[model samples]
Target: MSQQQDLNLFVDNSIIPQKVYRDEPLFGVITHTQGTSPSWLINLLIENALYGTCVINHEKNQHRQLRSNVVVISFLNDFDFYEKDLKRNGIEVNDNQQFHFIDLFTDLFQKINTPESIVKIFDQLSKTIQNIPNKKTILIEGIEFLLSSTGITSIQLLNQINKLNKIADALFIITGADKELIDIQHANPSLPEFKTLDFIIRLLHRSNIVLGLRPLETGRAKDITGTLTISKGTIPFDSLVVSEKEYLFFVSRETTKLFFR
Candidate 1:
C-alpha cells in the first residue's frame, strides 16, 4: 500500500481536530505487557513529535507543521533504554532540546519516603513543564506500574493526570488493559491491580483515540508481532470522524511494519 494509505489506515490526523488541554487530544495505548516493553508505536509517535515529520523506510512520508516538544514520564524504562532504541532506529533524541525524558523507573521509589513526596512529583513535573517554552506533548508509560508501586488511589492518579493536563498541551498515555488488570470479579479496591483497572477505564472514557495492542488470537508468528486496533474513545467529539480499524503489525530490527486487514 502507498505510504499515504498506510498513514490513513493507522490514523490520519488530518481528520482529527488535534486540540489540546480541555479539548486536548488524548491517545491511549493499551499494552498487554504488565511492565515496560519496547513499544514500536510509542517510539514512532515520539519521533514524529520531535521532528515535525514522519520518516518511513529511510524517507520522509508525512509532514506535520506544528511540532510539539515531548516530555517522557516513564515508569517502564530509563533514559538509556529509550536512547538506545532510538539510536538503533537512526534517530538521536537524547540531548535534543525538543525531547525530555524523566525516569520514574529508577530512584523514584527510593526518594518517596514520605506521603508528601507523592504530591511533590506533580510539582516537580509542573516546574519542568513551566521551563519549556513550546507546545508540549507528554508521553506517559507504565502508569499501571506506578499505581501498583505507589500508595495513590486510582482517582488520585487520574486527578494528577488532569492536573498535569491543565498545563500540558497534549497527552499520550500507555497503560495495561490485560484481562487480569480489567477483571472486576470479586474486585478489591485495595488491590493495586483493581486500582490500575479503574484508572485505565476512567482514562479510556476521556481519551480521544485508543490503540489496543495484543497478541494474535491465532497465536504468535515469526513475521507478525501483534494486532493493533485503532478506534475513537467512548466520548469522541460529535463533529469528529474516527477510522476504527484493526491491523497486523511487526517490529523489525530497523523499523516497524503495519499491515492493513
Candidate 2:
C-alpha cells in the first residue's frame, strides 16, 4: 500500500452510522469473533465510543481528550496499575478531564464491594459532570482477569456489563487476550472458547466495533516494513505477527482499520 493509503487505513475514518453500535444487541455482536475472544475488543470499542463525548467537550481534539482520561490499568505487577506509570508520567484526571487511565481494576471493581458501594463511586462521579446528565462513558482495563481469573463465566461477565450499561450510556472493558491459547483446543483442555473464533464473533455479535492492532512478535515489525517504524525502541509486535509457537488471526473485518509496527 502507498504511504498515503497506509496512513488512511490507520487514521480514524468517518464513523459509518449503520456500522457503529447503537444498542445492546449490537454490542453483543461486537464481542465474539471467530477463533478469538470478544472481551478485549469490546473494551477497545467502548473506549472509542465513550471518547466521542470527550472529543465534543475538548473541541474535537480526541487525542488530547483521550490522554486526559487515559487510565492505563495494567495486569503487570511492577506497573501496579496506576501509581507506577500513568500518574508518574503526569497524566491527570479531574471532572473536566476528557480521559483518565484506570490502571487498578481490582481496586475499582471488586465483586465483594456491594452494589451500593459501587453505586457510591459512580454516584460521586456523576455529581462532577452535572451538565452531561448521565455518566454514560467508562473505559475499564484488565479483562484477562474477568476471562481467566475472575472465576466467572463469560455469560456472567456479559450480565454484569449489562447492568453497568444501564447505569452508564457506554462502557468498555480492556483486557489482555492471548489468541494462541485459544487456537489450540485439543492441545489444551482448559478453555472451551479456544476451539474457534465463534466465541469471539458471538460475543461481538452484541456490540459494534473495529479491531485495532494485530498481535505480533518484537522485531517482526522492522522486518515487515523497514521504513515504517515507531520512534520507541523496537519490541515484539507479538499481537500482530503470529510466531511458530503462537496463534494467528483468522478473522479480520474489512471495514475496520489496523495499525501496527
Candidate 3:
C-alpha cells in the first residue's frame, strides 16, 4: 500500500461523524481472525481515552491507554506483567490507577466454581460500575473466553450485558467475535457443527454496529494491510452518510480509512 492509499483510508475531513460519538447506547461487535491479533480494537480504545473518555476494559493482557481515567480489568495476567507488557509495547503507564488486574487462572478458579459464584461475579462487576459516577464505555475483549470459563449459555451472557448496560449508563459496549469459526462455516455450509459460531451470529444480530477485520489479500506475515468492513449500522457524516450498507476500510497502524468497495 502506498502513502496515498493509507491517507485515503482515513475518513474525510479528519473527523469521524458525530453519530459515532453520540450519547445514545451503542453496542458493537468486532469480528477478527483467531491467530491474528485485533490491534485496531486497542487503537480505538486508546483514541477514546485520549479524548478524556473513561474506558473500562475486561480483556487479556495488552497495551493500555496511559491515562488515569482508563480502567483495565485484566483476567489473563498479573498487574506487574501487564505493566511490563505495556512498556514493551511503547505505552507508558504514568497513572497508577490505570489497571486492576485479576489473575483469573488463579483467583477466579478458587472463588468462581459454581454457577451461583458466577452470578456473584456479575453482581460485583455491576456494583463496581455503579460506584463510578460518570458514564462508562465497556470494552469486553473475549466473549468466547467468558463462555468457556464459566460455561454460561449465550442467552445468559446477553442478559449480563443488558444488566451491565443498565447499571453503568454505558454509552457503548464493544466485544469481539471469532472470525476463524465464521469463515469455516461460510466455506462449508453443509457442515454446521460449531456452537460457538452460532453464538457469535447471535451476537452480531444483537449488536447495533458490526465491524469485521481481516488480513491483507497479499497474505503477508505482518498485519500491515488489513480490511475493515462495516456489516451493519449507518453513521451519518456532515453532508454524506454511511447507512444500511456494507462499507470497506483499509486499516494500518496509523489510520483506518473507509470507502465504498
The prediction achieving the highest TM-score against the true structure is 1
RMSD of each: 3.4, 11.5, 7.5
Q: What does the lDDT come to for candidate 2? A: 0.34
Q: Write the per-residue lDDT of candidate 1 for residues 126-162, one digit (tens) a residue.
A: 8878788867878888766667777788887777777
lDDT of each: 0.69, 0.34, 0.48
Candidate 1 regions exceeding 4 Å error are 1-5, 8-29, 34-38, 57-66, 113-115, 238-240
Single out the weakest 10-residue window by summed lDDT for candidate 1. Answer: 2-11
Better of 1 and 3 by TM-score: 1
lDDT of 3 by residue, 1-261 (tens): 333222111133211223343444455566776434554444445334434221222222434333223334434445565555454434555554433333444565678655567667768877876665544555555445555556566566677666666753222333445454444534332232244565676766666656666666567644244566654444323343324333344554444544444
A best-first ranking of the candidates according to their lDDT comes to 1, 3, 2
Deviation in Å, model 3, residue 217 alpha carbon = 4.9
Worst 10 residues of 3 by lDDT: 6-15
TM-score ranking, best first: 1, 3, 2
Compared to the true structure, candidate 3 yields what TM-score?
0.63
Question: Against the hidden true structure, what lDDT does model 3 obtain?
Answer: 0.48
